[model samples]
Target: MAWELATSCTNQRVVGSSQIQNEAMQIGRKEIKLNTTSRAYVDPDRINELKTISSESFDLSKLIRLCEELNICFAGECYLSMVMLTRAILDHVPPIFGSSSFQQVANNYSGAKSFKEAMQNLENSSRKISDYYLHSQIRKSESLPNVTQIDFSNNVDFLLSEVIRLLKK
Candidate 1:
């Protein structure tokens, strides 16, 4: 399918297997990770179930406990745990979405692309979700805060620019 081909052509792609191996050597990497054996990746249904729970009913304390366990047991791939936590935030506590800390977590998982661009896209997605939230609200007088202004202009861009600048050194 077109989607499959497009995804396969993402920036993460290496031109050839030998090139990948060469790059790995230069980067001092030992392995080329095709798929992670993380339990979260294997269990799609559990992820979906956790995503559907209401914020009022959702147990943040329990999720934090799980995060701690994952951090201990799967410390090398802490990014997966972050993805899980971000998913939960998208489903339940959407307002706390674009905090500087969240942007830092995103930076941790970002690939070869500009992290600022990634964060900007995330904010755009959040805006769409917030529009939906506004429509669903019973009180018309209450307005959804425009977090995008606080996001792309200041925090994420600054953090990502600093990260990139450091990498150049």
Candidate 2:
């Protein structure tokens, strides 16, 4: 039955740049176009896990807990999940420049202006990595590279300590 439906589509053609074709699948009286655009490696379950304890301002203990979760994700080879969590962790530390933007968070932070600038640099760098993981459909047909050990170790450590320091002042 499935093969009949597949071969019945005579109008199927490779359109646009994507190798995937937007062909219509007919089921009874309903004909729906299949979404050929592949998605990135985002795991909904991991997203839910990250969202559970997410907050605008995390204390020392909560930061530790989040780090543990991140470590688990890294070990499990869930790189996209880990990157999303990394961005969340960065954004969770509050006191941004009257906004929640990553640049704002990095810019108007509680630490020294120079230190904040450094954080912004890190934020910008990580954002690229996140975007790469985000529009992952580009790599849908290709062999994906292996996810390395997430380096949030130092970045998270530094950000948490700095936030703690800022809170003290």
Alpha-carbon RMSD of each model: 17.0, 16.0
> What C-alpha root-mean-square deviation, in Å, does candidate 1 show against the real structure?
17.0
Best-fitting candidate, measured by TM-score? 2
Q: Which ten residues in a row have the lowest lDDT in candidate 2?
A: 14-23
Q: Per-model C-alpha lDDT, please?
A: 0.35, 0.47
Q: Estimate, for each residue in 22-69, the C-alpha lDDT of model 1 and write its tens digit.
A: 333454433322233222211233323333445542344444334233
lDDT string for model 2 (1-169, tens) is: 3233333332343111111122221223222222211111222233333334434554344444455445444334456666777777676655423456667777666657767766776688777777677776764476432443334444555565555444443
Best prediction by lDDT: 2
**Per-candidate clashes, comma-separated:** 0, 0
Alpha-carbon deviation at 145 in model 2, angstroms:
5.4
lDDT of candidate model 2 versus the reference: 0.47
Residue ranges of candidate 1 with Cα displaced over 4 Å: 1-113, 138-169
